[model samples]
Target: KSTVINALEDLSFYCMENLPFDLIESALDHLTREKNGPQRFAIGIDARDKRFVKEFKNLTEKLRKKFRLDVLFLSSSDEVLAERFSTTRRKHPLLDVGGELIAAIQHEINLMQPIELAADASFDTTLWSPHYLARKAEERYSGADLHRKLQVTVVSFGFKHGMLKPADTIFDVRFLRNPYFDPNLKHRTGLEPEVAAYVFEDPATDIFMEKIVDLHSFLLPAYYLEGKHYFRIGIGCTGGKHRSVALAERLVKDLAAKKIPNVELSVSHRDVMIGQGI
Candidate 1:
């Protein structure tokens, strides 16, 4: 559900994650009273939120009458949830001291049964990747703003920082030249022209991009046709300071140059200042 919430945030919705259930009405009241507050909002709720069951049981009907409230219950098979926890090596939110993984997953499911029964919509995301879930979320919750063009998010990350979650496509640029080896360039990032120029000076860089651009040109139309509104491409290198960032930026530029119909592009370098303490 974090993936879906993040997708809404990209669409300019004011988001509050894991908010206390009892504060829902008061929070909306305050947000509405502000002079220039957001018109759209996405609130994230789960079994772990304070007084979650109590609020749902006591106030869902009242809140729905007062506002255009929606409860989108997201669930997955217990096996899938267990596998994800193992892969990410993260504890389940509901895990108790000395509890087993499967037990924790089952416990959360049992606890949230009431909310599931009351949800206006429910999505079973057993096979969905994070990016795919993000796209689905936008389609499900964006109201009437559904005719917007396909949006692609290009993200640059470092392998050392751990693999980026929720990426649709990931490209490793570690084979590219190492700007970290150059004293003058080590402190700089790919956002700088000098670092970018240095990284792309390799003849193979352009050749690789040609194939990548071609591949996406063929793939994006299919995604758009299927009603997907969001895609994320992850670029990774050893440090994210140079090669990955440079390649990601180049990819954005190359795609923009294509001017593919009904497409919008944006880029972010996720770990550009990790070790620099900037």
Candidate 2:
């Protein structure tokens, strides 16, 4: 809980950990009274705190009456939780009560049942990477900023490697001239100036990119207005090293140049190093 609070503090959120249930109201009052108090705050409580867990609903109601609050509950399958404990070699809080690791996990899960039922939102972290989980948490708690913002993740992938999942939009750049055919560019990636020039210099490539940009420019705003929070755009080619990477880069640049308000862009070349030796 201290670790989580520290991380939130680093992100500029005023944080408190393990405030007793009885003091929550006073804590809020004190925070709001400070001249330099943070507009955003995070309070962390362990699920193992049975007293707090039992009173969570009432506490949540009281807090909601005073401020906009969100309850984010994170959990994972038993197997995943066990694996995490194994990898970290950390003792579970329930282990202090005298039980095996799996038994401790089950005990904790049982204790958290009521809180889970009362959560405003819940996430299963079984398959999520740490970075992905952090990104998701930030996005979820961004509050009012989410109303005006749309996150765009542009991914460049290779057809041979497999399709990217969870893509809101996908563009195939295979029809564009292949840079792999040129021995000079075969070993180079689209990030290289020579490879990028080769991929984008074709008239057909220009027309394709223009069409894609036009479509996205038209659709992105509509999606945002319709309450879409995140958009994933996948660009694919025979191999992710060249055409897809160049086009994804160009698309991100064009989107940024538009200066579309509240739109954040991120790009990744998923298969850029598929054949490169680690």
Candidate 3:
């Protein structure tokens, strides 16, 4: 369970481990009001909390109505659990004074029945490695990128609006040709064909794309091997209406190439519609 929670944190979820069930709704309200809180969240509930186990269904039903939820119940065999506690030389949470290890394991399993039965998914981890379990947890929540290992977020923003927020890397397409100066293309965004054509038509953009593609082709796989969960790339321009947006699209296309395996790609034009009636 700790491994899974850590994996969710690596995926940029704001995680609360061993969170008491009673405070969950109020905690979510607090997260919503924070100036820069995470939109994604993962909460770990302790089965040892008797009230939580007794009220699991009601609390989860309330949570589901207000927020999207998935409950993952993780357990191992009694023998394996007993061995783990013995190896760690630690007392079991359910163990009574001078109680037997196997007995405590069995008792906890019985206590966890209500939760395991109600969970969205349940996994028996007697033979599973922590790495394998963490990977499984990441894959379960990472969306349709089952075949990929890294998530890449490419966002285009205007320096005029603000510096791109907390990206892993940023590229200034401000050096590329500006479509804002063109009378006809001035009102258009890079999503339009003419603006995209004008931006990509620049010889400098072709060289820039080549260098970027070369750099990330190596960087993406290196980061994946380093066990990175996600990468954010920011593309900035003087005004996000044109050049940055166009190059961002082109970069997404280049990133989709077969050479970049196990990479999930997505792009956002952050300030594209700021001045427009969007």
TM-score for each candidate, following the candidate numbering? 0.51, 0.50, 0.50
Arranged by lDDT with the best first, the candidates are 1, 3, 2
Instruction: Rank candidates by TM-score, best first.
Output: 1, 2, 3
**Candidate topping lDDT:** 1
Estimate, for each residue in 8-92, the C-alpha lDDT of model 3 and write its tens digit: 8988889997677678889998997898877778888765677888888898787776665677899999888888889889878
lDDT of each: 0.83, 0.80, 0.82
Model 2 residue pairs with clashes: none
Model 2 C-alpha lDDT per residue in residues 244-278, reported as the tens digit of each score: 99989989999888887668998999999982311
Error of 1 at 161 (Å): 0.4
Where does the lowest 10-residue lDDT sum fall in candidate 2?
A: 1-10
Model 1: per-residue lDDT, tens digit, 50-86?
A: 3887578677766655565667899999999999999
Candidate 3 worst ten-residue window by lDDT: 140-149
